[model samples]
Target: MGNQQSIKIFLALMLSTAYIFSFSHFGALAYNTLFKNTDAFAAGTAIGHLDISEKTAAEAERLLEEEVEKWKAKTKITFSYKEKKAEADTALYEFYIEETLRTLKQGQKNLAAVDVDQEVLEEMIYRTSISLGTVEIDTKKLAADLLIGATMLDESGYTFHLENYIPEAVRKSETISKATVNAEGSLNEIKALLKKMGTVEIPAKAQFSFLRLVEEKDIQMHHSSALSIMGTAIYQAILPTNFSIIERYISNALPSYAKLGYEAKVDEKKQMDLVFSNLNDSAYSLQLSLKGNKLEAILKGQPFLNKYSIVKKDEQSFTPKTVKQYNARLESGETQVIESGKTGLLVKMVRKIFGESGELMKTEIISEDFYAPVHKVVVHSPVEPVQVTEQAETGAEEGEEEEQETPDSTTDENVPMPVPGAHSESEDGTEVDEEDNEGDEKGTEPQTSDNTGQGTDMPAGEEK
Candidate 1:
């Protein structure tokens, strides 16, 4: 019995020694894993597609950067519209590398239960867990950049669609309005302005200003020469002559649309402007262009209203007055006419909106415009007197001497004296004139006899 008891105690001591040795071994391994080799990852670790196992943290970071670069190189984004296309690289985006590294460290800290084995623990301690940082794209910036590229493409004769904005089919359109004007002067600037307007989409019930449509400031800034040339040409010329190609187009066009109760006009100073409501439920796009001598503003969209007619009333004209001035330089009874005048005008533009059944829906007075008149002028001159000659004085003195020597006529005391150029009946039945008996004479006035009744009187040898 004693021997058996001793054997049991020895066995107990052996078992206790075995347990102590095993516990010490495990404690040492745990300590090594927690402090000695801190630059490793736990089991089951990965970053993106890279399996960064058994690598130091620094080494893992390098590998992650290389992988991210490769991914970015392969990433490509493309935008297409009609025949235009634009591309961008993902490398341009911002990345969060440090944040990803911190995430990886946190993930490693939350690792699952680990079995302590010297060989296994040593292997896991060398493994690295990594999380490649995320890449974020700046959408606004991307869109802005894309727009610049697209504009260049468009200017090069390519059609680029706006991001996320595509045009739909045209459901309805018509010759809702039209304007005509005699085209004169350089149309270059007007055409350029229309081209800049290009194609624009307008929302429903929205108002579009012609000035806004052309982007007046941009043109003034970029194409100042064109604007200045056009403005000067229009301003210096006369009424119809001064009207710009754009002004004439708007003036003529507005009336047609105005007949439909759409507001349109060229102001008194002839600044062109058009204000109109879309009226339709759907959006509309307006395109302006110059075709030959015609300038057109076309609206494209679904129609919501009926067709109508414009009733233009009589055009009343003001008569111009003529002014006359006397000029001494001009000959007597002569007059010079200058400057034919033009009459003013006033027209009442009225529009009658009609339904499909020809029923009048509304009447609108679109405009009451006034045109000024020009006056005419005339100049006249006065007349001068006639002059006398030397031969006439000698003839008058001879006639007076002969008349004093001649005897006085006597038949009956009551008989009247015969006047010069007077006809008297002789003994014959033939008629005779006293002036016809005399030689050719130049005097034109009638001659009178003196109180002695001798002959026709001559005053100071002056010719009649």
Candidate 2:
């Protein structure tokens, strides 16, 4: 009898162990399933985190019914859910789902009329499901996890790759929006969604080119005989395009090429520095350092520029010598072959000033004939003194007599005066200015004059 009891006890222990193992396995599977189902529901129905009142939940359901009827829609399946309660450990919800379908003969009458297109049925199903909220998802962890996963997968998995490849294009393309999912059910339901997102091609054979330069003044100030750079770039697949060479040089360029990036400095030299990178089928970088009056260009970390061929082209004034002419091929009945004038801040001002007058000049070609005489400009500049003097004499100086009788006033030097052509620097050392000076010369300080206190010695045919 003791032996028998011992065997029974052993058997009981084995059964208990198996039961616990089985329960654990089931629990794990259920946990995973909850997330999977929520994901499917999210993809199929667009009912997202909803802050709905008891009244709104009912109203949404009613609205769905009305919308379905408006489409003259006949459905075999219809369902909805609502948030019964919001709880921390558990989420309570109520749901209702039903389907009715019938295959009717040409002459036979069917009670459950659901003979419809698959797409239409799918859409109706999705819309109806979207009307329900927390009624579908009860568990908090499951709901939260599914949302987090979907977001991660969508952003990292779906978008990251595309963005790395063709950033601008991919961002502009259409993707699976929440509203689209809610209305259409699934990604497959919307046939054109993926196609609309588009594709980017990376070419195997691509070439990248970049330009770099340093002024002669910079080289003289730094006391460097010459300037140079050296580096490397690679592409596994397609090449990069019009990259911001000046922007990404420090962060992306040097690291890609495995080169030591130095914070370049000029101790006694007055200089300018720039760095930028670009990638297309290939990657390219540009580094420019100016010292004294000399300029140098650096590629990677080695100099790849013709230092002897360095040129300084002023933006404010076009070089008539460098202007290239193309042979004009005239077409039959094509009489007008007007050449366009160069664009600049001053050009627009000329347009506005001339436009105000009845005799507007033809802006196609800007020559000496197109402008007013230089004396006219001088007249306008010295108008302030003449205007003030005339006003003082013409007006009945009532305030002047009262002030003379009572007291005197003094000028305040503390008042702020406008600093002409100056720019303010931000926290990051970026300069900001509102005046459009795209084609203006740099470092041209105002000069003192014989008569006037100070005036800019404007470049011939250029504006101040």
Candidate 1: where are CA atoms >4 Å away? 1-175, 200-202, 221-276, 329-334, 382-464
1-464 per-residue lDDT for model 1 (tens digits): 99999999999999999999998999899988888768776654666445556566787678766766665565444543211244533433344555555567423321111122333322222221111011122334434443442211121222222223322432335433434332334367667665565665667545545446446436442433333333222221111110111222112112221321122232322333333344334465545556675444554554423444555565566675554333456675676664465564445445566553457767755434334444444544433233344556677877753232232232112123333323332222233343442231222221112221111112233321
| Candidate 2: tens digits of C-alpha lDDT, residues 1-464 | 99999999999999999999999999888987775333221122221121112223244345333433432322121122111111111011111212211121222221221222334323433343332221232233333332332221122211111112223332232211110001112223122321332221212223222112223112222231111111112110101112222211111111211222221111123222223333222222333333233222333311111111111122243221111111123232222212223321111111111211233323221111111111100001101121245445545464453212321111111112225433322223233342322232322322233321112233355543
Kindly provide the TM-score of model 2 when superposed on the true structure, using C-alpha atoms.
0.19
Model 1 sits at a Cα RMSD from the real structure of: 31.8
CA RMSD of each candidate after superposition: 31.8, 27.3
Most accurate candidate by TM-score: 1
Clashes of each: 2, 36
- Which 10-residue window of candidate 2 scores lowest in summed lDDT? 375-384
lDDT of each: 0.41, 0.25
lDDT value for model 1: 0.41
